[model samples]
Target: MQQIINFLIRNKTFITYLVLLFIALGLTFNAHSYHNTKFVNSANRITGGVYNTTDAISDYFHLKEYNEQLVKENRELRSKLFNTPASSTERAQLPPGDSLQERFKVYPATVIKNSYSKERNYLLVDRGSRDSVGQDMGVITSQGLVGIIENTSSGYATVQSILNTLSEINASVKNTNNFGSLRWDGNAPDVVQLVDILRAAPIKEGDTIITGGMSSIFPKGVPIGTIRDFTLDISENYYIINVALFNDMTTLDHVYIIENLDREEILNLENTTNEQ
Candidate 1:
């Protein structure tokens, strides 16, 4: 206590000068409108700077939650795209109460594991059977297709990446009827091979490739990639196209799993017909 008193006494003159300086500054600010306005403006700037720094930190911490929300929103938007109405002529040919929504459903999933360096690369996603994700469902990202769901547990699933050697998807030239089988050569992660396209098809180097929708897997028009190059095969009957994938297989994160609601019925009917 005595040390504190001595310290205060020793600094009394400087302390008094500091107090008077503040009081004089306050009086000047109050007496002059310009000074008051300048002080208020300065104070506001300092407060705003502090608030901006704090808000930036807060937003940085919430980025993951924001990203998940964006993924969900994207899934909803894709669902709407799949359910959009057809042209007047197409709608007229449909049955009385049929809609596109009855055939397809989309759900969001996060990729927990990804491998693209291997020939048989597979991806693990956070969604599983519990989330309505099942075997043979198509998985895609906002940029392009990812893979097909192979196996599912209660809370997780495995995806056969488009880069896998065993993977095969029906794909076609965008805006045209030329269709082929999409496959990987087990060599390049960014490129896949599209075979069985007729030689006469009007294929260009930069032409876009999309899902064919011939099977019950992916919907029609889902973007796959662009044709990087093409050449005639050994037999020269078809063009083997090299497609540059839109999605970077090594950097996959958020994905959407698509389910064909009528897949079972379609498969059952086909099976019955085949029995005959």
Candidate 2:
């Protein structure tokens, strides 16, 4: 206490001057309208700047939550889209047993690990059996197809990336029955090969490619890529098309897993037929 008193007494002159200076400034600003307006404007600017900075920091921290919410909404929308019949006429023409609704289910997931350089590259996603993800489910992004779910654990699953050399998907040129097998040459990250498409399919450069709906895994019309170039094999019976992928396999993040509700039944019937 004595030390504080001594220090205050020693700085009394300076403290008095500082107090008077602040008082005088306040009086001057209050007495002059222009000064008062300028002071208020300056204070507002400082506070507004501070608030903006704080809001930006808060938004940055909430980005992950916002992304998850968006993914959920997208999953719902896609589920509806997949269930919708192509046309009301088509729906009426179909038998009640084959209602398009409830044919597929969509599950959203995040990529935890990705590989595109390896010959049999795979991606690990943050979804698994617990989330209803299963082996052979088709995975895709908003831009295009990713791959098929290969393995699963309680909380995670692996995707056999479409870039894998062993990957084979049924794909077709958009708006046509010209279908082919989509495979990777393990040579380029952005390009894959679509083999066995008949040369007379009226296809050209820049043609769009999509799933053929021939398998129970992926639905038809899901995007795969666009044709970049083509060449005839030695047999010249079919086209070897180079397709530029719409999705950058090297930068996968969020993905959706698609489950065909009738997959098991279809497979079982086919198995029984084959046995016969």
Candidate 3:
């Protein structure tokens, strides 16, 4: 306390002069509109520079998520290169009957949080309302189908993982018309079971399974995985077939949000027919 007092006393003259100088400067700026504007601008520039530097430091912690997003974008580009035309102009020249829900745009996003070890596991994606994402949109990685969007915020979205209890996908045996419901029974880390397929259906041990396009979320030919095993249910009307998922749900990182263009139209049409 004594040191502070001595220091204040020693600097009293200089401190008084500084205080008077600040008062004079403040008065000058208040009297002149031009000086006031200049002062305000200069203060804003200094504070903005400091704020920008702080923001840059904070953003450094998000590098992993950003890199994952980059990988997803790269995969989308590759998918378009291999399958879809590079530009809309090129597609305009193609045959008229090529339109479908799969031809719609896919936005890339990173899976910040993923789960597959539980009975009703869900995944959290980093894209959300700000990126035009909404509930019920299909989310999938490059390897295979993943899940559907369940909820969204300004900067994030939660997906109902394929491993969830309520998750359902329309699938069929490759090269045959045997369609069934794909569900996870809370077992098998890398496998899901196909149910409701008739026992009479000729399902080989290694028969391929794929999205049936019965629902508009996935394209018809999008490759799922192959069958691993099978067993008859107690009623014997259907067979329980094991499916080895192409995309490992446990190790997922990046994914695409598929926006089915004709989904609403088809749904509305189906409702109209049901009401008849």
Task: For model 1, give the 10-residue run with minimal summed lDDT.
Answer: 34-43
Runs of candidate 3 with Cα error greater than 4 angstroms are 1-103
> Candidate 3's residue-wise lDDT over 1-276, tens digit each?
999999999999999999999987886665343112223221123443454455457557867865876688688877776786558657656775577423666898877666788776767676778889877788876677898887676666777777876778899998899999998888876889899999899988888898897987776766678999999999989999999988877767668898887878988999999999
Per-residue lDDT tens digits of candidate 1, residues 114-148?
Answer: 68998777677777777888889999987799988
Over the stretch 1-276, how does candidate 2's per-residue lDDT look in tens digits?
A: 999999999999999999999987887665343112223221123433454455456557657865885787689888877787789647646765674866888998877666898777767776778888888999999779999987676676767889987789999999999989999999999999999999788999999999998989998999889999999988999999999999888767667899999999999999999999
Between prediction 1 and prediction 3, which has the larger TM-score?
1
Against the correct fold, how does model 3 do in TM-score? 0.66
- Report the candidate with higher TM-score, 2 versus 3: 2
Clash pairs detected, candidate 3: none
Clash totals for all models, in order? 0, 0, 0
TM-score of each: 0.68, 0.68, 0.66
Q: What are the Cα lDDT values of the candidates?
A: 0.81, 0.81, 0.76
